[model samples]
Target: MEISKQYAERGYAVIKKLLNQDEIEKITIIVDLIYDRWLNENGDALIEHQLINMHSLTHPRYFKNNKSERIKFFELIAPEQLTDLIEKMFGKGINFHNTQLFFNPYTNTKTPYWHRDLQYSLIEDSIQAQEQNNILSLHIRIPLIAEKGIELVPGTHKRWDSELERNVRLELNGHINSEKLPGGILIELEPRDILIFNAQMIHRGNYGLNKVRKALDLCIGKQHHLLSGFLDRDILPNDDEIRCISNNQWYVLAKDIADQNFAKEIEN
Candidate 1:
């Protein structure tokens, strides 16, 4: 309905009461299990695995690993109730881009700079493609606790940043205080609320200090989507979580997109 239009115009939409309390309880059980693992072990191995696999450019202090754990995490998320809404927003050819489980601690409350998801190398090409084709991709963020976290500048998705904004973002290097940033819109969400935003929009988080600020950032896109540099370019066919969520139609579309990107690499 109006949610899709609002998302296009403002680059984000907040769906209140999107998940009932019962659903939230079920999801929280899984989340707590993962968090408990991190707490008990301090997740040294998980962190080590991520450091080895991740591009050097990314330096996330906290994240969730364990494929089986992630499978359970996504299993709760990929139900038709959510995918159906996403498909309606962007039409067919949807593919899972990536999943991020953020656990920003109070000690490391400083957050990254305001930036668009498009890689710097791909920015110009992405802008051109968006103008020509209306390619809309987004991050569906589900906060497990009430938090005033995400901050963004509305309509930033449709326009490049101003000189001042760019300079500020560059100088701060993702360490600036989010609330102090000019023209920032702070989005406060409750436990069961859903906040979906175009990742292309300039945004950053305000780290929560009271408790472990936790959220799930799930990226989804149409076939021609360009995403952040951190994304794994290829989705392995044997990935159990992906296969569980995807049927034949979804698999074919995802495979075609992955193949096209791979072909481009070989050609270059």
Candidate 2:
């Protein structure tokens, strides 16, 4: 499939019905299993109540606190057709920075704040410097259900500046109106349809009274020194133990090692 020129110029693209029914079914099954396990393990906590009230579910410490077994599973599944498309955009030898499962579970929440993913990356001290790199962080959203979908503001990625992040967050919190914000195309995504975009794009999740909406969020970037160099100078192990496992497994193991090494420095 040809990459959309519109996406190249505007910094975002959507390819509809990219995955077949079988592939979608397979992925949905795996995702459902994971979500069910997570809920079963954490059902009675105050944190669960907070999640319900927030009308969203996210593991803030997901990358930092997960077991290697789950990570391995992700790594094994990383090199599928979707990753190939990302490799086309980001070039070969890319690294998986993180993956998240976003769920808007049956609520009337308006929409999430508009912001770029780069703000949260450890590479830059501020969003301004990160933007100067022109490094594109590829985001792939695979919807698990067809009810509620995300809306993307077209061409807004090119127009985004640091100030927009603040404005968008305030707008999401009911502090201001987003009328001035650019309008986006509403995507009715089918299962496994992938929407790829740069990190700076203006986008938000629209739950719209849907009972449950889930999506797998994957972030991938090139491994060149210009981009990867900022992550930290530490060398990742390449031994059999590390290479033998899947990419997801490697992430989990890496997090465990980091936690053990930095335990005392972290405050409760």
Candidate 3:
């Protein structure tokens, strides 16, 4: 069972101990630095929104005067082992879109909910199901702290939602989004493990069990019409900065897309 095959069949794959102890320690320290800043700024808002995750980890606004820290974080994220794994998953033309940091909601009362990533977007359910196989959006999760945080429905990536799933996910009929679906598997990950899952699969972040959930997700994949225009120009590296990056393929692709999108925005 190769990784690709397993991924294609199960909609997710876990690479255990992908990062060594040293790498894990460095990431944890930097992640805590970033998380503390974000939490300090958005603690109240996280409770208000019932948000369990934060995206766009490279945004310049977060760093402000601490540009060196941002660059260091970027360098840590693009290590040779991770980059090589990403290449093996999706060879060329795959862009690193954005980064997301997953943590527990500010309040313990907020339970997790199930969803495909596109369901929150403007795209309709029918359209998303029809185009499911065409898109390749993925969440490469790097757990900075060990936890059983993620629950995913296996094989859902290859098919559309069943009626029960639709009802539970959409909260239609008498069902609620938090209601557990059949075949849902809770994923337990350690500090150094990496898990790759389809962004469009039926999944949720399990809350309350762990007081601290610090998982850094490298959102990467092919740019599609359904999932384009999200790359923020300020978050991506410029021409000079990218030169110093190790395994710069993903960042280069991301910068190109960001530049193009920025130009398009200006024109419009």
Candidate 4:
């Protein structure tokens, strides 16, 4: 089957070697800078066990000054090939929904439970919002470090969980025991490999094995979908926040919705 068909059926597809070593190296530097800045600013509140944390670029201005490395990296290298594939999977135009850099640092070994992006309280109605011919959201995962990043139950995106599956999910609290469900598959990626999947898919990650597991999740959706607009509204940074990173025209649009939604609590 073709990549689009595979994604439509399985809810996920890994595109290998989508990036070269030089591109990966540059991204790694930017990721490290973001992580170090987070540590410096929030060391006291930082929880080592929660290794799958997200970060924002503080120097969007500097990065913007070097647009080829930042904005172009996302526009050309990251989503370029996936462009037609995405349109085929969802629709014609894709809107930037959310952006975040995931950090699974070394020595951290915790896994999140099996869950869908729709499970979040803020936008739990995602299923109802996704049209049969149009999807509300798609997640693009770019791995900067190699590891067993995410495991997903294939084809789970199209249906609600089975009674047994729901009960097990509730019991495990997202720490799904793959033994109980034999179909769960690990999504292992090499550096520069890309994985794009429906955000509604049943997935979990035990990131950061022996090495750090760094990835970027860029959520996008079909153009002009009301559901997409609803989800994006909750995640988009406010005008004041965007002003801080205005130099990078992309960062002005790309931002972590989780952080934006919980800005008050995160700051506190």
The predictions' CA RMSDs to the true structure, in order, are 5.9, 6.6, 1.4, 6.5
> What digit string (tens of lDDT, one per residue) describes model 4 on residues 1-268?
7877888788888888877888778767766665676677666555644546653443353354554444433443333455555666666546566566766543444545677665653644434345423554677887877868787889877876765566555554554433254478888888878898877767777653535667777766654333432443433444554454323333343444334445745687
Better of 2 and 3 by lDDT: 3
Model 4 scores a C-alpha lDDT of: 0.61
- What's the candidate order when arranged by decreasing TM-score? 3, 1, 4, 2
Off by over 4 Å in 3: none
> Each model's TM-score?
0.71, 0.66, 0.95, 0.71
**Tens-place lDDT digits, model 3, residues 84-117:** 8878877778888889999888778888999999
Return the TM-score for candidate 2, rounded to 2 decimals. 0.66
Regions of model 1 farther than 4 Å from truth: 35-72, 106-112, 119-135, 172-179, 208-210, 225-252, 259-268
**Model 3 pairs whose backbones collide:** none
**RMSD of candidate 2 to the true fold?**
6.6
Error of 1 at 109 (Å): 6.0
Write the candidate numbers in order of decreasing lDDT.
3, 1, 4, 2
- Poorly placed runs, candidate 2 (over 4 Å): 41-72, 120-126, 129-133, 162-166, 170-180, 223-268
Which predicted model would earn the best lDDT? Answer: 3
Q: What is the lDDT of candidate 3?
A: 0.87
